[model samples]
Target: MEKKTDVMSIRVNEKIKEKISKEADSKNMTVNTLVNQIITNHVEEGTVFQDLDFTSVRKQLLKKLFNSMPKEEVTKMAGTMCKEFFKDTTMYLYGKYDLESTVRTLESWFNSSNIPFKEIKSEDSIKMVIRHRLGSNWAMYFETMIKAVLEELEVKTDSYVKTIDSFSFRAYY
Candidate 1:
């Protein structure tokens, strides 16, 4: 027995159709096959990955490792580095990963550091809202420490950190 291919017509913008055609050609697939595969994927599986929370894994693993290390040493090193790295910026420790403990450790490490905000975790990723007092360089340094600490923890996770502008919705009046 052979499955019959039924002819279906769909209207789409010319530009979109052109782009789809190009992509299909690049992948060496016919338009019909590509569309069928997309539909089949949606129907068969809801998503590609099952359970992968990179952000939480990173935070948890780092928190564990840092907690294990001697607090005084990390604090001394961080304090010395902070003088050269961030002089005027207030470090706002944000994220759902153990805020109280992490803040305490960081405060102990850096004498002048301040924790202004903490983001609660509901789903997966953690968002830190650090004020721009330290400027972009300070933010970059903080981001570097975040990655280094997470890497040192050796957690099997992947993450994406980005700085985004305020999001707003507009309506036509």
Candidate 2:
């Protein structure tokens, strides 16, 4: 079934309207479609990001920082800080933190961070692969962080793999 939508009218500055029109044309979409996308994104993901006080940082800076940290320290930080971050963000976003919510939150985080990932699901397990160019330390951090989060959710992970630019793991619920 098609979802129902309500129509509302709002006034915008002429310059802003022109810019929106230009952007819509550039994207080969109608202004209405683009506006709906903007509203939906704001309501769904932007609000969560705002509430969580998320900030954007340059990828180069992040790569440098990750590279500078010792592997042991990176692992420890990921296990501790990233675990807490995932737990809290999942709870805040979903009102409850579980395997499903945590997975959803992680996907959203990856998307917002502009990271590429693939998730394959079966009846009893999920396999996630994240590809990046931030080196082995970043992969290690992700592996450790994912393990910590899954441990908190009481999910067992196996088939773990980490390379210089990618990480993958299979989690069984």
Shift of residue 37 alpha carbon in model 2, Å? 5.0
Best by lDDT: 2
* Candidate 2 lDDT by residue in tens digits, 1-173: 99998989999999999999999999999999999988876787877897899988887888899999999999999999888988889988889988888888878888778888999999999998888778888888988888888887788889998898888899887
**7: Cα error in model 2, Å:** 4.9
Off by over 4 Å in 2: 1-3, 7-38
Quote the positional error of residue 149 for candidate 2 in Å: 1.1
- Give TM per candidate: 0.29, 0.79
| lDDT (Cα, tens digit) per residue for candidate 1, span 1-173 | 99888877899899988988998999999998888876654443223112211122333454455455565655555445543232212122222333233433333233222324444343543344443243333334455454444343342233334332111111111
True-vs-predicted CA distance for residue 144, candidate 2, Å: 0.8
Q: Which pairs of residues have clashing backbones in candidate 1?
A: 75-109
Question: Which 10 residues in a row give candidate 1 its minimum summed lDDT?
Answer: 164-173
